[model samples]
Target: PEEQFEPDPSKKNLVILGTGWGAVSLIKKLDTENYNVIVISPRNYFLFTPLLPSCTTGTVEHRSIMEPIRSITRHKQAAVKYYEAEATKIDPERKVIMMDDNSDVKGTANKTEVPYDMLVVSVGAENATFGIPGVKEHSCFLKEIGDAQQIRKKIMDCVETATFKGQSPEEVERLLHMVVVGGGPTGVEFAGELQDFFDQDIKKWIPEISDKFKVTLIEALPNVLPMFSKQLIDYTESTFKEEKITIMTKTAVKKVTDKTVEAEATGPDGKKTVEVMPYGLLVWATGNAVRPVVKDLMSQIPAQKDSRRGLAVNEYLVVQGTKDIWATGDCAVAGYAPTAQVASQEGAFLARLFNTMAKSEAIESQIHELSSTLNLKPGNPGEIATAIEAHEKQLRRIKDIKPFHYTHQGSMAYIGSERAVADVSWLNGNFATGGGLTYLFWRSAYLSMCFSTRNRVLVVVDWLKSKAFGRDVSRE
Candidate 1:
């Protein structure tokens, strides 16, 4: 008979926060048999963020990229518990996390405390608004599934309103103008997808207003994709130019109104002047900011007072000045870019470290038992000595856990018109590629990186469907 999967009361309770790239990646690689695993997050699903931009324009459906967290927990050797709640406060002294059920369907036990022997805080960052006026009120964020759905709906709404009878040409142009702030990957990819949608579907369905449709990418920095190689950045800019997407570099958006974005635009002669641009849709993707939960935890720890970006973590990924609590992904200041690649790698590393720690504890227990037996019965000293020696060797091997080291694979981005750019690590150095072939590589790479085969299949289907049948423009 096979042993059924159940949580052992003797094992330590391991609680993890958030279901983002970091937490989910850790769960995927974790050995649950050693610990009583309990996951808590507001979202019940793990969202594949790479293809998230495609969802905004319906190039790919949002559900296709999201894998249910329950699906992951079900496959573990030991039965894992999941709570769909937001972690509000962390009492590190008591080793308890105060969580609240933020869902619509809430019960009497909506708020409670979950105690853990070891805690993993991977609660990812939120959108950064830089305290800009009207940003949060008027801009659509490119972070979650709801945000994508909202953008898609807003796109169609703008198109439909532009084609409305007796609408002025100026109004139509304003309505068709889609402004994207932040020249980072999210903003760039979304701009690409928005253009592709216009070229592919909107041009055929609503040709009258297609020519009026325009995308303007606003960046405070001198260039877009500052993280990518200069060559790749130039390639992206050229591709955007060819696609008729306006690139506004060295422009800082100061305020955003219902129909206008106020910004300081720098000209070729280093001249700066205020420009108020009209737009129907505004997508804010300026990058990440520390979440409130992380800030709260940081405030509780005196050592993390200087941590401005996020929680200050040591080289081992352990929270500095805190015991038994680890952090990964965007929540931790681990001297790495808050990309999915880094988060996933960090999650996997934590899993390995935890497994090693569990094994070491087991070995120590066995050695203690053996020593006690030898003390009780001195006649069987030979067998006891051999067992102790073997256990000691295993303990030594278990304790030799190497520190986490991040391996940068590379970075790639889609730049629309069936073109992409890549800065990949090849052999002992870096290899930069751009244009058509790189787009295919980009597609293949993202597909392979999807959380599951189900997600990959659904995403491929979505792509094929969008190519053959076109995006469904029905407002829901």
Candidate 2:
């Protein structure tokens, strides 16, 4: 439809933002022959975020769980055009998005405005810092593959510094202490993986510094894993206790300095007292926040005033403020939790809708042939038959064009080696949460979810190697 590049002038221009679960699902589901699909995001690859925690300990290499956007749309119905750039702003009136390729180490500057007949925003959330001072500067976020790599390096750096003979005892103690805030799935999982690495690898190679290393998990709530049932939460606490890892609950982190975290907690006598804990490394997995680009888009529309989190959307996943634009995942307050399942479902639904709209004439052509079979005798046959036949056929194909519905498959998290907790309903009835064997189930499930068979085989090999000769202890 555009001036320069229209292989087919009849094809509608469909632009999708972000390569997260939702956007990818949308791209996969759309019947591409009817529309020119373009995907734009800062990241070029789709991250299997659930297995991301394991990457911090080198158990799962970052590349294993990552699938290039081009690979996903490869065998799909339509080959989606991918742009490695971030959408800066949305001009609703002009039906255009301003995007710029983020360049630092990578030298690529293909920034341009992309016009769209239909738009989908699945821009995911960023790690929330909550305006906490020094957190952004000092804390390591576990949202992306790069963040996991930095954490791996920082963990080794702390160990190396702590064992250096010339350093002071106080400095060494700080270096040996690993502190994690927010006892959510990510925080708890990270703490578990770190301890696994130290126990399995670091303890054997550098036995001299083994006893000095410690891990502490702090949560502002009274108990960790709030999403799980009471028994599961208790089980996790007991497991952590047995592993000798510290679990501090009801602890509020006030601020974070270079090597210490200032916090406040209530005493046994019901008195609040401030405490400072020294740390070698701090991981702030306190969940997500709306990105600045999303905020700017939200502020532009008056109908989006009540939607503080991001753009509000109707059941059809269409943005409430505008007719053509739709939003999915964390960027939209879609009456669904910001989870991968919901995002993926929304994407699939959008694809079906676009496909149906594109092939409606085909369906009408099918209906026109059956028009003679109708027993209704009427003077205005053409007008009556058009409405009557469309309604009858729509009933049969309702599933192909209905609004999005999310099916919660429950949650699963790996605590440590041969240890996990799952709240699954697919098997074991409803609300099945346990550790030990369940951890194996978690591992196998995630391994099977790998983007490619190549990644799956490599991951299986890594696990087997670790089992045969312990973990790789080399810092580099």
Off by over 4 Å in 1: 1-7
Deviation of model 2 at 17, angstroms: 0.6
Which sections of candidate 2 miss by over 4 Å?
1-7, 105-110, 268-270, 361-400
What's model 2's lDDT at 21? 87
TM-score for each prediction? 0.98, 0.90
Best by TM-score: 1
Q: List the residue pairs that clash in candidate 2.
A: none
Q: Rate the local accuracy (lDDT) of all candidates.
A: 0.94, 0.83
RMSD to true structure for each model, in Å: 1.6, 4.0
lDDT of 1 by residue, 190-264 (tens): 999999999989899988986799999999999999999999999899999999999999999999999999999
Model 1, residue 236: distance off in Å is 0.6
Q: Which lDDT value does model 1 have at 26?
A: 93
